[model samples]
Target: MTTMLGVLLRVYLVLGFALEVQTFVRLYVLSTPIAALTPSLSDPALDNVPAFRRLYAVYCISLGLLRLAAAVDIKNKGLLAALAIVHVVEAAFSIAEVLVFQHVPPQALLDEPHLKTTGFLALLVAQALLFAYGYMTASTIKSKMHEW
Candidate 1:
């Protein structure tokens, strides 16, 4: 049976993909005015750094692929541990960004309280599960051994 963490990891990656699409559209297609793309996609900074935005999108996609790799190789405890840590860190970074940096304007969050709150809740859950499941999973795999 698949673990809940596995399922949620997949969903989170796909969501990351969707978010990348939005960021790409805003930066490339919609021509949303800003420099750096905000974590929430609500506002762009005053910098016109397409390269940074493009690379960030690539980072998201690559992390998704890495998660898939970790999932496929269950015996590789290192990969699983790394995967979990990376995911948790990603979620934490997102939450921190929301707290420390500029997020969607207050009016916007107020306008769609349910949607915003749900998104925030999902991030919190993702962060919790990553740590809870990551090391526990690593413990299940044995390290190298020599048979003589």
Candidate 2:
């Protein structure tokens, strides 16, 4: 179980690093306007650019650090705990955006892309499961440190 959990942590680490790089390129190097991106492609919570940037920074930092720690201490309880906390926050924010802004926005402001409600709901459920998995893995490692 510990080995499996460690593998999962590494996977999360890769995802975190990829997201950080992509966001950095989009926001800084590319100088791409966030609004120009398809609204449906990103979480509507990102509608507020400043807030989104701040939250994204937090996500990137926590994920990068935690993943690196996991690599060093494969069964590190502290790293798992930190990662669980961050994932929970991200999952919540993503879900909230879907719920609060699922509808199409005004055409005058930004053209709303078509959304597959079922697909969106499925994605939300998947995110929730991922968060739960992170929480469980962290707690399990803490409780059964030797086994892991």
Candidate 3:
């Protein structure tokens, strides 16, 4: 008898894990071609740095693993809370990178040929929504309770 929140959280966690793993693969294994194809979407300073790309890939994979763990143990409140916080941080960093850090101009974000920036921003928004949903779901879980 899993609640709707539990089901949603599980789905979100699984999706997040898949996306993170995909990001790791793209960033590490296909960095060169991706960078060449989308120079404007890449960071010029770290684009050619293999070490940085690998480090980022590791980070992405680690996050994916965390999401996978949380998805498996969906009744763990602590893990859900941590994942919510992680999602918040990820969304915040992405927003900062685009707005505060000026990685991409605010006005030019949606002006790209293929809507890359638009997709990036939309993903961030989705992550933010996931964070809220995760937090709510976590709060609904009781300590020492295993079943959702």
Candidate 4:
């Protein structure tokens, strides 16, 4: 039976990957929903929606790919350890997002009233959980004498 932690980890990865891919698709492809995605909950003066949205898409895709790889090789201490580092770094960025930092701007439309409250909260929680899970899983895995 899969433990809750294991399920949570996979759920986090899959949701993260799906959301990123969805954002990328909506941003670069069809415009049905993208047209309505110009969320203005933040200070427009400091936010670069297009630029940050693109960067965010790239970040999501890359992180999702890495997380997928780690999930595939969860038993490898090396991979898990590396993923743990990545998760912490990503969590830092996510924290910046929560704080409304321009360095980590919100993805376009993701902060809209419709999805704003629940979605943003979920992202924050998921980031924290993933970071904790990553570190714990990495430390618990087998590793060489010098490996992390």
Candidate 4 wrongly placed segments (more than 4 Å): 1-4, 31-51, 78-87, 94-122, 139-148
lDDT of 3 at 71: 87
Q: Per-residue lDDT for 1-148 in model 2, tens only? A: 7556656656666676666666655755564555443233355445557766655555555566666666556455566556556656655654455456655443322223434433444454564465456556665655655532
Clashing residue pairs in candidate 2 are none
lDDT by residue (56-124, candidate 4, tens digit) is 557657767766765665555565566667656655654555456534344643556536533654555
Task: Tell me the TM-score of each prediction against the true structure.
Answer: 0.55, 0.56, 0.72, 0.54
Candidate 1 on 8-32: residue-level lDDT in tens? Answer: 5446645655665666567556665
- Model 3 regions more than 4 Å off: 30-41, 103-107, 110-114, 139-148
Reference-based lDDT, residue 51, model 4:
70
Against the true structure, what is every candidate's RMSD?
Answer: 6.7, 6.2, 3.9, 7.3
Residue 107 Cα positional deviation in candidate 1, in Å, after optimal superposition: 14
- How many residue pairs clash in model 3? 0
Give the lDDT of residue 15 in candidate 4: 72
Would you list the C-alpha lDDT of every candidate in the order shown?
A: 0.54, 0.55, 0.69, 0.54
lDDT of 3: 0.69
State each candidate's clash count.
Answer: 2, 0, 0, 0
Error of 4 at 144 (Å): 18
